[model samples]
Structure formats: structure tokens, C-alpha cells
Target: MNYQAPLRDMRFVWHEMFDVTGHCQHLGLDLDRDTLDGILEEAGRFTAEVIAPLNRNSDEQGCQLLGTEVSTPDGFREAYRQYVDNGWASMTGPMAYGGQGLPQMASACVHEMLMAASLSFRIYSGLTEGAVLAVHRHGSEALRQTWLGKMVSGEWTGTMCLTEPQAGTDLALLRTRAQPQADGSYLITGNKIFISGGEQDLTDNTIHLVLARLPDAPAGVKGISLFLVPKILTDGRRNELSCGALEHKMGIKGASTCVMNFDGAQGWLVGEPNQGLSCMFTMMNDARFQVGLQGLGIAEAAFQGGLAYARERLQSRSLTGAVAPDKVADPIIVHPDVRRMLLTQKSLTEGCRMLGAYTARQLDLEHGAPDPEDRRAAMRRAALLIPIVKGFFTDVGQEVASLGVQLYGGHGYIREWGMEQLMRDSRITQLYEGTNGIQALDLVRRKLMGDGGAELHALVEELSQHVEAAGHQPRLQEMAGAVSQRLEEWRALGKTIIEACQRDPQEIGAVSVDFLAYSAYVLLAGLWLQAAVRAGETLTDGTGESAFYQAKLQTADFYWRRVLPRASAHREALLGGANCLMAMPASDFSC
Candidate 1:
């Protein structure tokens, strides 16, 4: 099945639900509705025509390593060139650096479409943006002048080098060493593993943001510092870094995941000394949200493919009656189980799209708002939501993709169908950018308890206000009420968990996953309610296409009735406490 960008839904969320034009005005940007619409349309055309067709072929061919150079599959390089030529790589970068300076919302929509087209292909540009943001926020003037413009223009690419052979999640265990040279630069010597786009031939140079230790520094994570290590030097000599090997993986075969060996590589420090993790968080936070978008994109593609197959694939007659009487058998869509699967995918995908867009708008407000109070509030909300977006979206993404495969039955098992490929590609999103488990812990421990639940309480109040404003409308009254009720329950659950954590610290770890999932369901309910209200208003006015508005209402109802109940299961799990989970000892299983 062909991939199509969900432009109508995206436009509705941007214009109707979020008031993105108002955001543009707040930021002093000259982005009108027409321009935004045109951008979305052109982006849709580019991804569908140029990028989507390369997905399967790139996966089949993968990447080849010849000595120190890594070559992408056929069409990959040209497609990237087209992407850069179209200025997509710099869509949301700083305008002073040859970028379009668009808001995160616009960039978010474009990214969703591109990721749906090919996650492997999108990785190259996404990493570059992350690196650009880091330098823009923390790099020295000389560093910015030397590298930021080229990176923003896609003349070069970037990578985040954090992992080592001994340290995967624990940065305190890192062994990479950075020795100071006579000049301002340092000699970075260590082996970094699992670096995405680490050795690709997509750009003239690859700038690595690495974390390493100084000789006289303190022990553990405190001693680590950030550095800029280029693949090639400014003096026209190759750096000491090389691709030691490429890891063979189950998914995203087209994306090169490399083991990089930096042997006395020339580097420059970023930010203050012994504060590398803090600087890295600037990029990591952005990356977490983007990974969440990746999940939404994959889920959307899977849903479209499954829905199309269900409408076309003939099966046994409907239980009630034959919907397609002229055919040999009724379409599988007539079956209740198939409808359940399709609706589940639809509910999750649409809800995720709205949530992702909302989060993107929050990011814009956090960065662009003139008032200090507004920026702080936006920052808190963004922090509270990022983990949920990352953890729940990816978990549900895997579920949706698996259902897509199930919808195809035997055909999904074969490589020709493409469903399995999506599933494989989506699985890694949950593992990388901090594992979903780590995200859950961060949500409950760092964001929630770290701030004494103030951010979460603020979010609950905001959702309550939205529900109250829309409560009078007939079509939205039920959803509004449901959301309000869920918000109260979420607050109560938060209080209970906080009280439990005060008694036993392990309680936080035991229930974090369930708490994160529960939070996501409630949050998505509010977003869906917002979408339903806007869609209902359009229908009441009798403007635009009726079918599109109707689908919005139906999907919202499906989410409220079918998907929202999952929150109860998560609530029960969260309240189950830590005893059962900690009951088993370390060495008792084998016997």
C-alpha cells in the first residue's frame, strides 16, 4: 500500500485545534495560513513521490561498507540530495543560518510524513537538526561560525556519540578519554558504539557531539564533557575517527548503525567543563520528541495499509448479513474482529498525531515566548509530556503495526507485503533515545516527584479548563465529561503514588511503566476531545467536507469508548504495589 500524508487531519489540528497562526504571530514570523498550507502540500508531494518509493528498495539493499567508507543503497544519496535541495533539512533551523525558521509544529508535520516514508532515510537529517540545536544553544561563537551554517544547509551531517562498549545507559561507566592539546583542541581517544549515521557518505563531513573524560577531572558522570569531533579537519586532513564496524540489526537496515573508534581525534569542548550531560540533554530532549513522532508515523502508515487491505480482501460472509452481496464473499471489514483491529489502529494513530502536534506547539511556546513566566510554564508542560509521548506512543506503535501484520494473515509473514518491515523498523524506537522503561522512570521520578507534581497538576488544570469551555456543546459534552473525570482520577493516582514512594523508593520503579501509560491515555483523551469539538463546530457550520468531519467525531467516539478503558488496566497495575514484582530472588528461576 502507498503512503499518503494525512494532510486534512494535520490542517485541522494546526488551524482549528491549535491556532498555529496565532503562534506564528507571537513569534513574529510571517507565516499565514495559505503559506503553511502550501508548505504541507509540497512536503506531502515530495515524500510520497520521492521518498516513499525508496523505502523497500533501500531496506532490501541495506548499506555496504567498503574499507573506511560506507555507501548507502541505490537512490538513497540522490533522495537525500533532493531533500537538502528542497531546504527540508533546515526547515526549523535558525534563519540567520540559511534556514526557513519555521515553528516546530510545521517541522513536526513534515517529519511525521518523512518518517512514514522511510525512517532510515529520515535519520540522517534528524540527527543533523539535533546537533544544530545543540550548537545554537551551547557552542562558542567560533564553533557556531565554523559549523552551524553548513549543518543548517545540509552540506554536512551530525551524530551523537554517547554509548561505549561498557556503558549503554550508564554514562558513569564511560571510558572514553579526551586529552588536552597545546592548542585549544583536545585529542579524543575511545570507542563509541551504536552511533547512527556515524559513518555515512551522505555529507561532506560528519560532526560528532561526543562525551568523554579529562585526565584531571572528577570520577563518574561528573567528569564527562562534551566535544565536537569532525570526520575531516579544516586543514584538509582526515580525523583519527573511523568506522570500526557496522552492526547487523533486525530493522532499519538502510540506516548505518556503527561502532566508531576515535583514536586521538581532534576535538573542541562545548559548554562549561564537567557539564556534558546537561548540554547533551538539550539534544536528547529534542530527540525524544522526534522519536515519538517516528512512532506516530509508523502507526499511521500501518493503519492506512491495514484499512485498505480490509476493504479489499474478501472473506467469509458477515455475521449479520452480506455487505458485499455481489462479490463471492463479503469484505473482511464486515467482520467485528477486523473492525476492532482497524478501529484500534485508527484511534491510536489519530490520537497520537494530535498529541504530537500539541507537544510541538508547546515546544514553540517554550522557546519563542517573550514572557519569562510563559516560557517556564511551557517548559514544565513539555517536560511532563515528553516521556509519555516517547513511551506510550512507541508501545502503541508496536501494537498497531503488529495488528497490521495480523490483518494480512499469512501474507504479512512474507517479505513482499511490507507490513513486517514496518513492525521491525518501529521496534527500535522504543529501545533507543533512552529505553521506554527509562522514560517511564524519568516521568515518575524526575518530572513528577522532582517538581512535587506541580507540572502535572498544572496540566490537569489546563485540561479541565478546556473541558469546561466545550462542555456546553452537545456533540462534545460526553467526551469533555470523560476527560474531566479521567483528569481527577489521574491526579488522585499521582497523589497515591507519591505517598507510596515516600515510604519505599522502589515503589516508584515498580509502577512507573503503568503510570506513564495511564498518563498518556488521559492526555490523549483531552486531545481527542479538543479535535472532536473543532470537528463538530465545522459540521455544525456546514462548511468543508462532511465526511472528514464525521470521521473525526467517529474516531473520537471510538477512542473514548474503546481505547480509553485501557487506562483502568494500567491504573490497577499501578496500584498493585511493589511486593509481587520484587518477590523473586536473583538466582531462583532456573531450579
Candidate 2:
């Protein structure tokens, strides 16, 4: 399984759609063409040669547990060593803390390649980033000094410990308790479930950023505090608690998902006593985007696999003339249906890649841009897109992976083909890191409603400008038109959902998921139009790879033609409100 990344697509997004050079100029960063090219080349090489090979082996071996210790698959420790040796783990951290200090756009490009090559293997390393960012942003100076350097270097690992068995999605019902110790430390006693990288032996120590309620704290997410509980105490060589058990899961089998027990564990507080929930949410937002990338990565891999298979696998004669008459059967590539699946995967994968990088670029603008107004606008845009980044990318991940399986027919389900693995691995991306449904609710209930929809109106209006600018390109024009139409529909549907919520607060529980899908479709469609116009420009230049640029153009067309149409029904479901959802009673769920 040799993996050649879509380098051409990445370059297109970086140079054309995202205006990376302009962004770098704005940031006072010296990222010339040669520098950017060298970075992408190195990242793609590392992903294909180093990270990808471990996927199959990791899936087969899974994680090993002995007593209180958990070890990752066969080559993980060595591979992780190489990953750290190359400074890949430090890309997003502060230069003062021994990090590479690369732009987030560069990091996003590298991440998509790494994840596409080996999502399961990358999971172990990815957790360290989000957790480190949380600590760097919110931790005390002493805490930052103690942990940031080592974690950034991958000498140690980190975990975000939220989600108890009973308190998933709803933090108000959490039961974990943190009792303060006289020594300024705390004693944590709680059970954490679905904790990724929780108790892995891939590093010297695993730091758990646990959210627990203090003994004298308030109730319902107010009292939740973030604690830095290391597997080993300060001395860093003793086990304080135990890995209760490894979760037997549906996907990303190589990454250890653990049910952990923190029984009177010695822990130091990461932030203010009662500010843990807020602190953890900062990490969650970062993790949410990364998890969305998990979907994008797996989907890219599946798309590549499907494309290769379609080119070579001879299944039937085409309805049209024989493209490969020499072969016994026509290559699957000749068939319209096969092309549909391939185009769907390619378009979505490319669009999502650009969207992810666009989001990353916005993050960079928010963080590094000189103008305060520009920073504020970029931050707002990033906030608006986060839900789509988290919800839309992951949903398409499952859809694209399933399409990969479909392309393989019966062979896809078998272990050898690896299509099923793609589907299985991507399934959890939508489930965890604040489920897609929760993401939708956040977008509509929180982000859109802010300042009485001023931000929403601004974003939609901004996207409308992009659409208007896309008038010359037919594909872009169509995508722009469709998305603009959907936005209006979404606004109307949003008002209906809001009205329903006013009547019955539980209306959210009914319509959140479908509403999320609808919102995601609109956002993705807008992104597709943006990329389509960029691709059209590249095609006009005829400078480099015309075929690749043309492919992007055609895929964008396919998205508008085939994919965005689904938004109509999804919008209808949202407009239907809680009636269909609430009309059914709990009794109807009985078997």
C-alpha cells in the first residue's frame, strides 16, 4: 500500500485558495516558496514512508495491556521516537518552549497527510498537541515550565480526561470529585471512560488532564476543575493509579481507548479552582478540529484507494465504447457509476482539505495578524467554521469511507482490501470529541445566536461576496448559488428551531443532529465554491498540472451537482422542528 499524497491539491489550496504567502507576509514570517515546498515535501515523505507502514500492523496487533501498564502496537514506540526525532510534534507549540513555531496552515497540511497515512497511529501523537495547547494557554507558569517542553518533544504523552460512563455530552451530571490537599495538590477519585491515549506506554509518562468537581465546588459544570494527574508522580517513575481496562472499539484499534480509575490520585491543578470546564473547553475546540481532520484523513486514504482500484480493477463493460477492449472486462474507471463514487470521494476530500487548511489559516490570522480588527474578524470566522469543520468533515468521512467500500464491492469488506478499516476508523471521529450532534447545537444555539445573529449575518454575507466573485466560473457559480440559497433556507429553519426551543427547551434534543448536517452541507458547499474558482484560475494558467487542476474543477462541479442537493431534505427536516421527534414516545423504542 504505497500512499502518494495529493500534493498538487495541497499546493493549490496553499498558494491559490488560502493565500499562504500573503498570510505569511502579514504574520512577519519568512515562508518563501522554497521553504513551503521543502516543508510539504518533508511532511509528505514522513507520512508515506514512516507513518503509513504502521497502519496495518497496528490494526492487527492493537494495544497490549499487562497489569497496570498499557503498551501500543509493535512499531509504535519506535515510530513515535522517529516522529519526535523529526520535530513533527513541536510544529504548533511556541518557539520559546522548544517548538518549530510553524504556521498552523503548514501544520494542518502535515496533519492531513499524517492522518490519511495512519490515523490510528497518529492519534497517540495528536492528543499531546491539544493537551499541551490547553496547558500553555491556561496553566500556571510553573505548570507550563514543568510540562510544555517535554510534552512538545514527545518525551511524554497527554490525555484529556472528560466523559465518564454516565456523564457523556452532559457535564452537569458528572460525578468525579477532586479533594484539595494541604500541599496545594489534590486527591482525585473518579472514573474516566473513553479516554484516548489515556494509559499508553508509548511514552515515558502519560499526563491526564482530568476534569473533576472540587469538594466545596458549585454544581453543574460550574465546579468542574482541570487537574494535571500524571501516571507517575513528580519524581516521574511511579504508577499512581491504574488503567482499568482498554476499550474494545469499532475503529482506530491501534490507539488505546481506556477506561481509567483515578482512585485518590495525587494531582496538581492546571488552572483556577472552578475554571476547569472553561479550560477543558479550550482544548476541546482544538481537539474538535483535529478529530474532524481524522475524518478527512481517513476519507482521503479511502478515496485514493478507491481511485487506484477503479483505474485497475476490471469489473464490467462500459455502457459506452470499450475503453479497455484488450482486457476481459472494462476497467471500473470507464463506468459512470464507479466514476460517481470516485468523484464524490475526490471532491469531498479535496474540498474538506482546503476547508481544514482555510480554518487553520484563520487561526493563524487570529493569532499572528498585526491588525486587531483583522484578528477579531478571523477569530469570528474561525469560530463560525469550527462546527462545520468538526461536524461536516467527520460526516463526510463516514460517507466517503462507505463509498470506498462500495467501490470494492465484496472485496472492500474483507480485511485484505482495508476499505472496511477506513470506515471503522472514521466512525469514532463523529462519535467522540463532542459528537457531531453537539457540534450542530453549538453552531445554531450558541454561535449563530450571538449578538442577535450579527456574526451569522456577517459570515453569510462574506460567503456571499465569494459567491459573487465566482461568477465567471460555471462550477463555482453553481456552487455559490446553491450555498447562498441554502443559507437563506438555513436562516429560516434556524428561526423555526429557535421558536421551537422557546416553546420546548428539549426541542434541541430532537433536531440538533439533522440541523447540524444541514448546516455542514451549506458550509461545505460554500467552501467547495471557493476552491472551484481557485481551480478554475489554475486551469486557465496551464502552468503546471492541468489534469489535476481540471480534476479539482470537475469535482467541485460534482459536489454542486450531486452532493449539495441533499441539503434540501436536510433543511426540511430542520424546519419540521420537534414535531416528528417529540411525537414519538419512549414506548416506541421497545423491541
Candidate 3:
């Protein structure tokens, strides 16, 4: 099934659940409820109509590369043109640089739609936002003057060039070099692999943010520096960089993942020397979170497709009895097992949307909160949530996609129905934007234990208040109780691990993924309780949206009673310690 944007669900998360307009107002933005609603509505319409139609075709044709030039799949170029023409690229950018300067949450809402519609097409415009933000936050005035406007307007797309022939995640092994020259520009020579959108036909030029080292710099990651290398110079002369090859991958085939070779390319520096990792991180963080949005979008699309198929496909009668006696057999949706798969997809999809939107609100707070301390607190909160958003959301997204395939049986295994494409596309999100394992390590070792668990403590404190209050309410008591227990379990488990890590350095690594998963369940359960409460409010207040609110409450009930139990298993695994894993001798293991 072709994708359809879940507008009502999105509105529930953005407006009803969080009151995002109020959040925007507090961020000091002029965006009101009407304007935000219109923006989301338009974004929904655009993606459903223009972008979704091209997804299957794009995957089949993939990207084209000839003589160092890469062209997108057939309809992608036109769709991208419409995307830029609609001012989508600059909606979330800084107004001082020719953008609308809307709240980040507004952009998150739109981005979720774009990502859901066509992730492959979205790849072309996606990196531009992060690149624009990195330059705005850290680049010099002249650099900003030259690049910001065009990029914000979607005239030039961007790429992050950190991967090389030898270096993957280990930047210390990077060998790309930049030679300083008299004109104040450096000559960059290097080859980067797995560079998405390294070269594309959609934009006028491609701006690459490359990581390289100068002659006098130090060793390892400390010596690395960030550079801006454009494909075409201001006067329209082509630079020395070219797309050496395009990777033929399993999925997201529509995106041009390339091997780019830079031969003494014209370049300028971004941020200080020997601080490239730090600077690129600004771009990376934006990318990481957006990748999580990618996961959310893909999951939503997969669920929609799967749910639709389940309702129509007839099979054996229900175990209890035939729901459709007139037919030879009932729809597969009548089966309890089928209901299980669909509910799993639904609960996870809805929970992740809340998770994505919740994190976006913190980001809005980080950028716009009036008080300095409030902004810092929001930053810490966002930092803690980022890894969960990146890691856990993508993990569940893949699970949902796989279930979508399962729902269709043999039909899902093939390319025709498009379910397999969803599965293939969803696979990449967990691997890229720093693998989910890396995300877990960052969550546990860095965000959780790094600050002595301060960030997570703040998160627990905030979520606790709502959960504890809900426990006293009549209808919310059971859901609240389940979530409240998990919240404490998470806090205690974290405390135990932090104390153990002081004695054993590798202690954190052993259970980091498990801990991250555990934390994610707790966080999701907390958000479900919040949503359930709001749905109860709507029902009590008689909004006349009883069916919608009831469905939401039922999903929340499923999450708490069913999904949240996964946290207990993770906690047990976390407490199992590092010994069993570490005891295996390196030399003894053989396949």
C-alpha cells in the first residue's frame, strides 16, 4: 500500500498531547495554533500526494552515476523541486539567514511527514538543515554570507564526510589532509565513503562538510578539523571533487551513497583547528535526532500498510468463531495472532511518535527558553533522550517493519507489494547515524554515568511527578502504577551499575545496550501514561472525539500491561554483570 500521512495521530501528539503551540509561544516564537496546524496539514498533503507515489519506483530504478555525476531516480528530481519550491527546506532555519525561523518542533512535525513519505528523496534535503545549523552556530561571518542563504533555500544540498577507506567510527585513523594556502583557503585531498547525497542532480551544487587534518596538527581525533568544500565555486567553476562511485545497496537505493574523491579541492575552515569532531558533532547531533525521525516515519508507513492489508486479506476463520459468516473465510484480522502483530505495530508506532515529539520539544526549549538555566537543563535533557531516540526508536522501527512483512506472509517477501521495501529501508536506520549499540554506549557510559547520572536523574524526576499523580486518579491507576514501578526500577538499576563501574571500567559496556533498552521502555511507559491522561481529559470534557480518545487509551493500556514488561528482562540482563562476556579468552574463540 502507498503511504498515507497520519494527520489525526500527528495532531494528537503535537497539539492535544503536548500543546506545542503553547510550547512555541514560550519559546518566544510568533507561531500560533492556526499557523502550526496549517503547516502540518500542508506538509501532510504534500508528502502523501507528491512524494509517496515515487517511493517504489525510486527503489527499483535506484540512483544513476555517470562520469562523476549522480542523478536521482526518475520522479525524485521533480519532487525535490516541489519540496524546495514549497519552502520546506528553510522552514526550520534561522530567519536572519533567509529562513522562517519557526520552532524546531514545527520542523519535527513536518520532517516526520517528509521522512514517512519518501526517505530516499528526503535524504537530498535532510542533510542541508544540519549543515545550515552547523554553519550558523559555528561558522565565520564571511563563510555564513557565502553559504547559508543558498543552503537554507534548498538551492545547495549538504553531506557529512567523515568515513574514509580505512576509518569507520575511529576518527583517529583518518588520513584526509588539508594544506593551508596564501589565499586563506585550504586545498583538501581525500576520499570519503558512504557519503549520502555526495553528488545529486536536484540541487545547483553540493556542499560537503569534510573532516581532515592540517600539517601541524596533533595526532588522533584531536588533530581533526572541519572544512566546507563546494562542488561548484561562486563563479560556477567545478571544484576538484567528483563522485568516484555510487554504492549499490540493499535498501534506500534511491539515495546516492557515494565514494567521493577530493583532489586539492577549494575549501574553507569551519570552527577552530583540532576541533573538527566537536564542530561536526553539531551536525551529527542534528543528524542523529533526524535519523530517529526517519525511523519514526518508516515505522508509521509500515504500520499503515500492514494494518490496511490485514483488514482486507481473507483467511481462516477466527479461533472463537467466524466473524464474516457470509464469506468462505474471515479476514486475517479476525485471528488473535494477527491482532497481536497489528497491536504490536500500533503501540510501538504511537509510542515512538510521542518519543520523537517529546524530544523535539526539549530541543525547542534548548534553543528558546528565556532563562539560561532552563536552557541548559533542556540541553541536558535532550542529550539524554537523543541516544534513546536514535537507538531504541530505530530498533523498534525495524521490528515493526518486519512484522509488517509477517502480516503479508509470502506477499511481503517480494518487491511487488512494497512491504519488503519498507523492511529494507528500515534496516539502514539502526545501522547508520552511529549504530544502535554505539547509541546505547553513549546513553549508558556518557549520558547516564558521565555526569554521575545527573541528566537521567532530572529526566526521572520530571516523569515521576506525572506518573505518581496519575496513580491517584481513578481510571489511570493501573497504567500509572505499572509505569511508576518501572521508573524506580530504572533508577535503582542505574545506581547499581554506576557504583559497579568505579571498580570495573568495562562494567558499563557489558550492559549498556540492555540499560538503554530498559530506559527506553520506562520512558515510553511514562509517555503512554501522559497520553492516556490526556485522552481521559478529552473524554471527560466531551470533545465529541470519543472513539479516537478511546483507541488512544486502549493503546496506552496495551503498552503498560504488555510492552513495558520487556524492561524487566533487560534489567535482569543488566544485572548479570560483565564476567560471562569478558571471561571468554580472545584466542580461544573460533567459528
Write candidate 2's Cα lDDT for 1-591 as tens digits.
567777877888898777787778779988887788788999898888888888988888899889878889888888888888888888787877898778888788888888899888888788889888899888989888987898888888899899999998998888989888898888999899998888887787888899999888888888789999888777756645678899998889899999999889988898898899889988887898898888898889999999888888998788977778888998898898998899888878887887899889888888788999999998888888888889989988999999999999999989898889889989998889888878888877777655445676776776777688789776466567777787787667766777777688777666777777776667677878887777677777777577876776777778888988888887666667667767778999889
lDDT of 1: 0.91
Tens-place lDDT per residue, model 3, 1-591, is: 777788899899998878888998898888788888899889888999999999988999999998988889999888888888899988888899889988777788688888888889888788888889888888999999999999999989999999998998888999999999999999999899999999989988989999999999999999999999999999999999999999989899999999999999999999998899999999899899999989888889889989999999999888888899999899999887888889889998889989888898888889789999989988999999999999987888799989999999999999888988988998899988799989988887888888988777778888988887686569999888778788777778888889988789788789899998898888989988988888888898898489999998898888887888888899898888999899999998987
Q: In what order do the candidates fall by lDDT, top score first?
A: 1, 3, 2
Could you list the CA RMSD of all candidates, in the order they appear?
Answer: 1.0, 1.9, 1.0
lDDT of 1 by residue, 396-462 (tens): 8899999999999999878898999999999999999999999999999999899888888888988
| TM-scores of all predicted structures | 0.99, 0.96, 0.99
Clashes of each: 0, 0, 0
10 residues in a row with least lDDT, candidate 2: 447-456
lDDT of each: 0.91, 0.83, 0.89
Error (Å) of candidate 1 at residue 351 is 0.6
- Write down the lDDT that model 3 would get: 0.89
Best by lDDT: 1
Superposition TM-score, candidate 2 onto the true structure: 0.96
